[model samples]
Target: MTSKVHLPYFDHLLELLKDQNQTAIAAFGRHVHWGYWEDPSSADGSIPDFANAAEQLSRRVCDAAKITDGLKILDCGCGFGGTIASLNERFSNLEMVGVNIDERQLERARSQVHPLNQNSISFVCADACNLPFEDNSFDVVLAVECIFHFPSRETFFKEARRVLKPGGYLAICDFVPLKFSLPFTHLIGKFLTTSVHNTYGTIKSNFSLSTYRQLAQKTGFITRIEEDITRNTLPTYPLVRKLFRENGAAETEKITAGAELVSKLGITRYLILSFEAIDP
Candidate 1:
């Protein structure tokens, strides 16, 4: 039988891509968009008013965990610091730190975020599984839509437990693998449609809720909340297709192919899991 994965840090590779693509705008990876809500909810199937939707998602998360003012927060795998910026506003006294593997994203985060706020928010180039911080360093650790990329779920959970205080919480909102090795086209669609990429490997190892919960539990985190954001993201298909079409057929085909792959692979869901770290 095969053993569970335990990923190693690549010290040399880290320095090479440290400051590659720092943009002058916000951190949406591809675009400078703030919220991940380019939806089509109206009669003409126009994009949904996701500003409210995005805010609600962020607010719900903060409210659920009692994330208040003046807490030291860590955003693991924070892409472009969008979540960090949003949460910082929600909590006026929040000391926010965003860590991303992509140097380009961190650069853009540094440039776009306010200079005064810079003191409050620090963006660093670091790996999620291997964080550079003392134990019990944060009050709350938020991994919004960015943890699956970690080479090992076990390593991530261990690190999360290490850095968080005894009662500190870990909230993750990202894609969960339902099964291992999804169709390549579905994997490709996920990237093209969402403007996100897979730096780790193929779309295989996409896990289910139970898979994630088990890993979290194994790492000593007590699962507190788990919700599916799949339906919310799923219904936006028409709008995504339309946008792809406007971009042209070749692009649309690639996007649709990815979409179909997700459907065929019985992988049509996204997840958000929240847990509290147990002190030994």
Candidate 2:
């Protein structure tokens, strides 16, 4: 199946994995997102350390969603089923479905993740903004570090609300710009367009926290959690850059460095946000 999105980073990772690159498999075989360290200073910058931190990041989002046993869940943009695997391990009797537009990633996910601890798992290739599930079918919907790649956040939010049962939760992590940074971000985005597209594909990182709240309200949801964990995610940049460099992706490394700079300057914030579906 043809994917609507074009993420070059994933293409590189898949190639490396196919070639039996052990470090690449170890670092990104599961989760393809940034890591979260409880204490940034204590991050040891090893493959194992980064992998553990990545798992922690997924758990943090799940915790925000108030995930419990026996709840039907949908993980949108579920790259390689990492979060689904994590959830399958921690919870029992869960009806879990992972949705991604890219079938290649879903193929790997299907091969790697299986039902465990009485949890059922399935991976579907579908757009985040156009889920194939029935309305009000899921108790929780998660989008971990992938909202920026969606065609439209507003549409995805509306779809998420539609798919969730009443009082169900939607949890996501994203790079949110501060209100004051929007103008500057737009200006910089124009110049970085080609480079960013070549490295990470289309990304929309100009959404501010206030805009998120407005989106939640407009989409029949109430904002529940908006925690900024940018500091904790800082340790991910160095490790990711090193990996990119080792893999001979100079353009990707340069783009990642730029992202790390903006993040360190507080121009962009990494946030975990959860919203509860409400009756309209």
Candidate lDDT scores, in order, read: 0.60, 0.95
Which structure among the candidates has the greatest TM-score? 2
Q: Candidate 2 on 54-101: residue-level lDDT in tens?
A: 999999999999999999999999999999999999999999999999
Cα lDDT over the full model 2:
0.95
Model 2: residues >4 Å from true position, as ranges?
A: none
Per-residue lDDT of model 1, residues 1-280, tens digit only: 1112221111211222344423211112322221233342432433344334445555555554558777888888776666776776555777888887777567767876652432388997888889998999898887765565677777888988999998888887766555543465355546553332322222233566777778877887889887765555553455445544553444434544565357445575566678898877
Q: Give the TM-score of candidate 1.
A: 0.71
- lDDT, residue 225, candidate 1: 82
TM agreement with the true structure for every prediction: 0.71, 0.99
**At residue 33, what lDDT does model 1 achieve?**
22
Candidate 2 worst ten-residue window by lDDT = 1-10
